[model samples]
Target: MDKALNKTQDRDLIKGFMKGNDRCFEVLLSKYKTKVFTTIYLIVKDRSIAEDLFQEVMIKVVRMIRSGKYNEEGKFLPWVVRIARNLAIDHFRKVQRNPIQHESEDYDIFNTIPRSEGSAEDKIISEENTRYIKELIQQLPDKQREVLIMRSYADLSFKEIASLTDVSINTALGRMRYALLNLKKLAQEKSVPQSYENKVQR
Candidate 1:
């Protein structure tokens, strides 16, 4: 669907959900569950913890909406994303754990890559390249890595990312800029394929 249509649909769904329509909530969940889960997973890097957090985030969102605590003026996806990000950060703080750890069971980096219509072989090659790039992203400094993951995987605007990270817009932009530059340098150092370089540029 087009961006404008999607926004309209989301608004309608939110209205329905606010009116106690369980089906509308299900529709919203179907649309956003993957994005929400992936955002949490990218941060926590633990599938089990991420899954638990995802359920908690959803429950909180529903309760907030039902109690009229959620702002209807805000865009739904970004609002939910902000909640997910905050909760994931809170989890790390509570556990006194580093959130950037590289530990996951058979994680699929393909979800972070943009979809394209291509041959089976092309898709396979693209997935392999994205896996390598994901590792490169993981190697970045904490701030840079978090910014990159939020912008790239979660489809968050720099403004939203700045707010979430409690940094100025310029700082968020700087981190993303440095992330790309560092990733490109690493790709060159590792002699990754030209196709992968092209993907990074995109």
Candidate 2:
């Protein structure tokens, strides 16, 4: 579907739900459930907690739309994603479990390499390089790592990331710049494949 049309449909659905058409809400939920759930799971790293948070996010979305509190204009997905991110963080704070481990065949972070021409890059990965790269990402300072994950893993635009992170767009861009630079340097030090380093540079 065209992006603009998707937003228009979301607006229509929101309006329909506001007018008490519950089915509109179902359509919206069915469209967004997986992405929203994945956002939660990325932070909490527990399926059960992610499922609970997903329900909370849906309830909040429905209530906010009904009460006219959803003031994000036409950007429904990013708005809901922000809610999911926050709730996931709040839950993680409560449980304080092991580090997050993202596992998604479709939304895999490896598919997000800079030179990645979509799925073409997925076939080039080596397990050793993958582990090294993941470790390098973890070594980044918190702010840098956060920006990189949101941009690369969540596929958020810099504008959306800045809005969600409450920073200027330049700041978001800068963090991503530094994150990639750091990763490239780390990769070089670890002597990862030149192909991987090339992807980072790109």
Candidate 3:
């Protein structure tokens, strides 16, 4: 019920913002700023750069909305997420930077995982497993990793992902399939427990 209410409220805010209500835009930013920044940070893995890109993303989103080019049929968060992802990817392409490395020491990857209801031992074990899986994800080919990250972290549908990547739906699906297969293969090679393997798929 709260989720539904929040969605409705977000839509109303967008409507108001489109009609030139500046306060509505502020509310919208307050609601999604953390989520948007986090999504970009996950992909880019740099705090300062992510912050700069986040501002650029918001500027672009506002421009699109004001220009009446933003697609209202889609949910706003996913739309913004797609924009941020595209901008980050474009930055990387322009700079020809090396792909994101899984720097476990540099950042606490475990913080990204949700804390499940369990004992301390179970939670620790889960975090360890999640970290291991994320490391494996980072090892995937760029396309596969991007698809998996969008699907898993951004909560985007395969169709949306296809559109974002400028690929056909089948290609997006294939990348996700390959990503899972590669993860599973890595898990086996690493001797990860079967239960953790199932969790990775989930």
- Candidate 2 runs further than 4 Å off: 1-8, 72-74, 96-140, 153-155, 185-202
- What do the candidate models score in CA lDDT, each in turn? 0.80, 0.74, 0.80
lDDT of 1: 0.80
Question: Poorest 10 consecutive residues of model 2 by lDDT?
Answer: 109-118
Model 1 TM-score, all chains together: 0.78
Which 10-residue window in model 3 sums to the lowest lDDT? Answer: 1-10
TM accuracy, model 3:
0.71
Compared with the true structure, what per-residue lDDT tens digits does model 2 show for residues 1-202? Answer: 3344345587787887898978778778878776676556545545556678889999998888888998746478888888888887777676566555544545544443345354545545564466566678877887787788777666678999998889999999999999988887777777777666776768
Cα lDDT tens digits for candidate 1, 62-131? 9988898888787788889888888987998977865355446567545555767899888878787767
TM-score for all predictions?
0.78, 0.62, 0.71
- Alpha-carbon shift of residue 12 in model 1 (angstroms): 2.5
Off by over 4 Å in 1: 1-8, 97-120, 191-194, 198-202
Cα misplacement distance, residue 119 of candidate 2 (Å): 14
